[model samples]
Target: MASTSSYSSSPCAACKFLRRKCMPDCIFAPYFPPEEPQKFANVHKIFGASNVSKLLNEVPPHQREDAVNSLAYEAEARIKDPVYGCVGAISVLQRQVMRLQKELDATNADLFRYTCNEMPTTQPAGAGIRRINEAAAGASSYPQSSVYYYNPSPWNNDLCGDGYQRGGDNNM
Candidate 1:
């Protein structure tokens, strides 16, 4: 048997798939190593080998790696989920982010409610009522009142008890 040192290194996946010699300056040599045949296979299946080669030729060498990664990710996503693929995954992640944000907002609102309830009413009850009215009037003057105005008077039973009377109206 020939010595191991005498045996030449294997060609890259691209070169091997194309049944051609892997040149030192081959574009696919770095990205499509001989060890990972699946990378090249995925790329080839999604975007034909000729198209990939052309794309590599058109773009600068530095950008090729990122392009290859994007291509591979898209190919894998497509193979796994042919119907919606990467777009579906992205949409699902966006929805999750939105849900988490809403939960965070609710938690913050609860914290604010708890903190406000804990603070001692230094001023007379009438003065607090006056301040609330003033804040409401000020908020109404602005077009975007929702951002500035938060009804501290608890509307739900979970947050605050119906201990404080509001202008003789115990409904709230």
Candidate 2:
């Protein structure tokens, strides 16, 4: 149950945006609070006041909050991109996941090769750590040598090795 304080203070987002009095039994009061006016604005703009009210009423009481949240998210996404909307965002995220998976596969392959003694990782002891420290201390490009530089930072790995950050570029 929504408290009387919510009712007594400024109106709920729906009522405030709709320019109406918020009674105790207002349908949108619980889910759309007075503070988050944008949530109700986007929702009402996308799905209309009567439609959102009907949806909330049709949904089970226990699930109304989740329904409202989903509506708000979709509304916001739709406002950001009218043509593709949520699908565009989902596609971008899917591509990011696929790329990460491929990187993971490449890393695993490197690990397997190292474990099987297939490649010559024959650098002096503590050289990788020293290179990491130098890179951390603001060295852009290390000397071209057999020493494999190991940068702990994944994004800024300019190391000349089979590391995944060699030539590929990404928006993220």
Every model's Cα RMSD, please? 13.0, 9.5
On residues 13-131, what C-alpha lDDT tens digit does candidate 1 reach at each position? 88888889877777788788777789889889888999999998998977988888888899888888888879989999999988876565566456546545543567444332222
Native RMSD of candidate 1 (Å)? 13.0
Model 1 score (lDDT): 0.65
- lDDT agreement with native, every candidate: 0.65, 0.71
In candidate 1, which residue pairs clash? none
Error of 1 at 21 (Å): 3.0
Which regions of candidate 2 fall more than 4 Å away from where they truly are?
1-5, 118-172
Candidate 1 segments exceeding 4 Å error: 1-8, 123-172
What TM-score, to 2 decimals, does candidate 1 have? 0.62
Collision count for each candidate, in order: 0, 0
